[model samples]
Target: MANPSLKACFDRKKFVVAPGIFDMISAKVADGMGFDCLYVTGFGTVASGLGLPDAGIATYTDMISRIGRFAQMSRTPVIADADTGYGGLLNVRHTVMGYEAAGVSGIQLEDQEVPKKCGHTPGRRVIPAEEMVLKIKVAAEARRDPNFLIVARTDARTGLGLEEAIRRGRMYGEAGADIVFIESPESEAEMVAIGKAITDKPLLANNVEGGRTPILSKARLEEIGYGIAIYPAVGFLAAAAALERAYSHLKTAGDSNGLPASESYGFGRICELMGFPEVWDFERRWAQPAAKE
Candidate 1:
């Protein structure tokens, strides 16, 4: 079962940090590491699942399938990125229902138009403020659980400007969005301004490492009045680096001997993580003995 609603955490005015995860194993690892929440990143999903960039190529069905697995793998609340809500207001409603049924505690809806790129990527465009507001309303109404959070994201900071992004964020908040995310603020001053401009609602900061935004610690984010800090590429980048190193060693050495022992999990430990021991115990307890000769 999933953990308690993220609303409780938000209500306390405590800053929440969610590490972005792309797959079931990453979800399990993040949950095991005691993260209170997980952000199912669309960017990571596209790169890992399709080997493509976040260019709005992933379909609604693709997102739903991955999110369902994330919801099942994570023991804590899952905040999924519902890119462009996959379409207009009606599609937003359907997206909300699908994510809710998948047990996600929060769904982030962005204002980018169809074929949206990653927030940090260039050449992105956003829908008009009025249109996005309607989508937010539809998303809010579609959720069966009132505590299920609707995070309204605006990529206007890059296309229009920070002021326009703030305007869209405020408009979406007024339309009943639970959280407002101003994607890709280029400076700490911009981040502070966003926190100040959208005071009526909780703000979410995207801490995409090596991206446009500066990666701030959770404490610094709280000081800036942001409610949530999401590290969307931390695990993915780390995993890629590790894989590159491992493969390079294997190719050069013709074996894994050159790799550091501390870098890998033991065979027994890997089995334990995969629940092999539990499977064996279940078989021993429930299976009948084989017929004797």
Candidate 2:
């Protein structure tokens, strides 16, 4: 079973912080940082893992295999991104089963057209309300564990505005989504208004860097009635942007002196993740400690 500590965090009135991680190293870092939960970000997975855009490019197995590592490393529960359920209603059923088998505690599916792009990006499309409702219904029914959360996300705010987005969100909620995420609201007013509109159930707010939505603080989101705020690409964006500058400096000046120096992860840190100490301990029953040369 997934971590119950995560459920406690969810039950609280305060907003939950789900840091997005694309790989095992990031997942370990997030767990070491003591995050309550881990998010397997579609955007981060597409960019960091595959070096591709989140235009519905990744496959179900590809994503699940990646998140399975995170679930193993982090004691925290994982909420995976199942973009548009990888297809229609039947596809949603398969997606749910696969993610659940992968040991994910929750999955967030979007109501977007096939080949769906990132929520923050332009040129996105959505499926009909009825179609998405069916997807949500199938996904909720397919889950083996009743505690496994099914979040129905709507990308209608970009095309149909907040009114239609809220309408679809409610429809999905009725279809048996454990939570609702109306993605990419434009302003603070939209965020607050969406929160107001969906008062019955927990609402999820996206906090993607350089995205369309305003970067409202978690404090503001909780006040607006949002139960969770997912910062899907914060780490990836920060790492990419910072590394680009550092690499540029190194190429141009033959030195990375201007780059901010983070503590070197070095051998010991690497060995810990690889369980080198445990391996050596298993080999040595009563061996003396190594002496300094």
Highest TM-score against the true fold, candidate: 1
Which 10-residue window in model 1 sums to the lowest lDDT?
A: 1-10
lDDT at 248, model 1:
89
> Each candidate: what lDDT?
0.88, 0.84
How well does model 1 score by local distance difference test? Answer: 0.88
**What lDDT tens digits, residue by residue, belong to model 1 across residues 50-141?**
89989999989978988988897677899999999999788899999999998898999998989889989999998889999999889888
Per-residue lDDT of 206 in model 2:
84
Residue clash pairs of candidate 2: none
Model 1, residue 188: C-alpha shift (Å): 0.6
